[model samples]
Target: MVVTATRTALASADVLADVSVVDAETLARSGAVSLADVLVHLPGVEMTRNGGPLGTTNLYLRGGNTNHTVVMIDGIRIDTQSGSGGATCQAIPVGQIERIEILRGPAAAVYGSDAVAGVVQVFTKGGQDGFTPSVGVGVGSQGTRTLTAGVRGAEAGWRYALALGRETSEGYNIQPAAYPDRDGYERNTASLRLGKDLAPGHRLDATWVYSDADAGYDSTTSKSSANYAKDNRALQRLSALGLSWQAKWSDVWSTRVMVTRADDRYATLPAPGAVPSYNTQTQVDTVLLHNRWNWREAVWTAALESRQDRLSNAGTQPRDTSRTQDALALGYGAKSGAHSWQVNARLDDDSEFGQYTTGALAYGWAFAPSWRLTASVGTAFRAPTLYQRFSEYGFAGLEPEKARNREIGLKYSQQGHEFAVVAYQNRVSNLITFSGAGACASSFGCYANTARAKLQGVTLSGATHMAGVVWTASLDVQDPVDVATGKRLARRAQRLLKLGAETGWQTWGLKADLLLSGDRYDRVTDARPLLPGYGVLNLSATKALTPNWSLLLRMDNVGDKYYETARGYATAGRTAFVGLTWTGR
Candidate 1:
């Protein structure tokens, strides 16, 4: 079941929003080390990463800004008030995740602020009905090595899960033009979850996850020269905790109360020094009360949320700031005969930004036996982060960014064959952008609302099971531009095509896929320098040696393709991985 679309569990086919779900099995088969790698394969998603998997990573959903997409762990939001004002994708441990739900349009009506583009919710692995233990080891290109062990079990109305993982890689020269050095990265992760049924209709759950990474990168600062190397590295930590109590009053009503906290920390130090040249930390705390009711054939939802964002910068120019938001949201959904409808509304009152409201309306019609058409319209807004308004180079008067989106979709589904076509246009005003100093102390740039954007796109996707194989494909054509300049958004391609095929032999399961992307602007400062398009092919296969053991092989970038998502940073050209897993079933 997917809950991101309307803040309540619903079948994927019954949802009116454009959405996708990726399970743990898919993640394991993708042979990806980071969340960013897996996201790029989804429809209407674009990624930009500096250096390698352990670099500054950003995801653009439906041509929105990096911060426009709201990321949640379990049911808690994870956003930073420092450094780009978004979640740190590089710090999330892929091995600990059980599933991911992605919504590809405005979702501020369900989630509170900072969902101008959409929402992504990640669920960690938890205990099932039986005891299960697993251990896996892998070796990959660039001297990469990985080890993971996990266990899940349930007994006597109690459930528990524990997972641990570690990975290290010897990377290549990330930015040779600035400083020539072999960048490397190391990460360690751990996760824990526990749940208990206190009564016949009451239950409680708690979860915690933590990861730390040290990654190498070349700095563009004046501390390094073309002939000299400072050997810069970033130390990062990400952690999240969630506690919830769920109660079912009757067959028609249920309520849940949850509290969650997340923290993001980064310290960039040069020359392996004891002191960090730059250090910052951001923490988010949230409390939510959600209620759902089913009457007749309709579903109703109401929720109340309070969130706080805090930022701290420790150094010679130390600073600390915080802000809060309180919100109330309501939603309704119904399916009668061949027509379905969904509506949602939310109001957020920020400590600094006063009040803002958002709403969404969607309708679906089953015109034919196996065909459905959907139309939706929504509004969203994002308040400025604390760092953007209180830092040395910040503008105190920065305003919230606002957007309105309209979309239509047509779909056909029968048995295991499915196809869809969706078209969307989003117009954003009061867009927060960095420009010449605006009443700030720094000579560099400061954040301000000085731009408008138009993001329009079309997506065609299909999946089918035929001839003993499953095939899936998607194509995206988008034009994301600045209203005044008419220049395309940096690092966004105009066209992208992805194709995949999977099959199972007598003893082996095999998969193959390809990616083709169009050209893009190298930098946001200018669109003159265009980065050429490129294609990459990947292959994977798994063999069951025994009931308890299995072997996996994967080859990425099989054609040795060369491409760059960012101008100076080099991409991982080619890579191969082999793994062995032992499961106690």
Candidate 2:
């Protein structure tokens, strides 16, 4: 289902945006433990982690800033409000997700604000047709262990699903050069979803998810502190709750109302005899109301949304602050013979940033039976984060970051093969950067709108099935640079390539993935050395012993290549995992 692109349920082929969908079955077969693992292979996507497993992870979509992307879980925004204005991607458990939708490029016209980059929406598992229960256990390298249990089914007029999971690991040393101590991690997660059909055209649904994690990390880089060799720890908690009601007034009209709340809590403890401990908590509440009209050749959508963000921290200025936003959006799509078009517009009033407007227009032409050409232009914006405006070194007068983007795409599909190529460019203004060169220089550093940037890229992707084997490949070539200084954006590679193959015979299957990344600068400066290129290979296999039981094995980092996505950070070397599962048919 396509929801992230247009904020409506439509077929993937009908959506006028670059989108990718990953289902639960695909996640299970890939043996991916984190959301980053699955997203890293997608086109126009990049991920950077500070260290192994439980590290601070960041995602950049189509060369946009880490905070420019919006993440939603079951229609609820879960972006963090602490010092870093990014989503808690590392804290989300994969087992609880039934599907993921990734939309690339500007989406502010449909989602507003942080959709400058794109949107990633996660949907949890729902009830099945009959009573079904499952359990699984696994052991992996670094003394890792995992346990999970879940049950879901439909009974009478009600449907419900519940899942619980736990994981712990005696992780390897993250900084073996300066700090040889291992950095372990532990996590617990629970998810529940319930839905009922009140009548033929009305429904009610509710969902909740809770996650808690504790992870160990190293101190700052050696150049920054003498005690950088010491070890530190952090604890995180996340909870999300959502409720929705839907009604079908008639065959041509439908409406939906939803309310959601998300809470994020984080605490950090210094190593022995080190700095003092600190904590931060963030809460977000949102309400949405939308109506849709579907006719023979056209569809129209209108939505109203209100959201409040509250943040409390022990180290930041103001200690507590809140921001509220109200938005209205209108969209229309139509199909005329072989040509289709879509237009969307949004108006937002933010308590801190004032009024803002954004819009997008897209067109598609089916030139041939199996070929299509598409083009789009859009505008997007990102409000300054609370920490950027209210922290001890923050600048309260900063303006919102904005961008205009355009793209053209060509797609072809025939038989069991599909291919697509898209080229896009984005120009950003009022770019916010942390600098100590202006009036706030004495404050160490403060965020200011002092720079501009341009990002242009080409993405190529294709998939084909032959002789019972499916092969997929994607390549991204881009130039992301600061317009004034002509410096490359930090941590964003100029080129990325991914290749994968999957094949199964009878009850046995095998899958392999390869990723290659070009050199990139750790900092956007001419003096910093470039981080060398790297490649990694992963392999996995599964064997079905019976109709109800299966065995799985996976090997990661087969070559044990040492690499770092961020300076002074260490990544996993060679690792392996083995597991078994039982299913009730």
Instruction: Name the top lDDT candidate.
Output: 1
Runs with alpha carbons beyond 4 Å of true place in candidate 2 = 437-442, 526-529
State the lDDT of candidate 2 residue by residue for 1-585, as single tens digits: 688888889877788798989888778866666778888888888999877666778899988888889999999899877764878788888889999999999999988888887899999999988998999899999999999999999998899999999999989877766667788899999999999999999999999988999998877656256656366888989999999999999999999999999998988888886567879898999999999999877889999999999999865667998999899999999988789899999999999888899999999998999888999999999888887777765778889999999999999889979999999999999999887745442357777898899988999999999888999999999998999999888899999999999999777899999999998889886476468789999999999888888898999999999988887788889999998888888
- For each candidate, how many residue pairs have backbone atoms clashing (under 3 Å)? 0, 0
In model 1, which runs have C-alpha deviations exceeding 4 angstroms? 221-228, 272-276, 315-318, 527-529
Q: What RMSD, rounded to one decimal, does every model reach?
A: 1.9, 1.4
Which ten-residue region of model 1 has the weakest summed lDDT?
221-230
- Taking all chains together, each candidate's TM-score versus the true structure is 0.97, 0.98
What is model 2's C-alpha RMSD?
Answer: 1.4
Per-residue lDDT tens digits of candidate 1, residues 1-585? 898998789988899999999998888788688887888888899888888888999899988888999998888788888845888888888899989999999999999788988898889999888999999999999999999999999999999999999999998777756656678899999999999999989999999989999998766522344434456789999999999999999999999999999999989877644234788898999999999999989999999999998889752134877889999999999999999999999999999989999999999999999999999999999888787777777778988999999999999999989999999999999988888967877788777888999999999999999999999999999999989898998889999999999999999999998989998897667737468898999999999899999899999999999888888788887899999999898
Give all candidates' CA lDDT scores. 0.89, 0.88
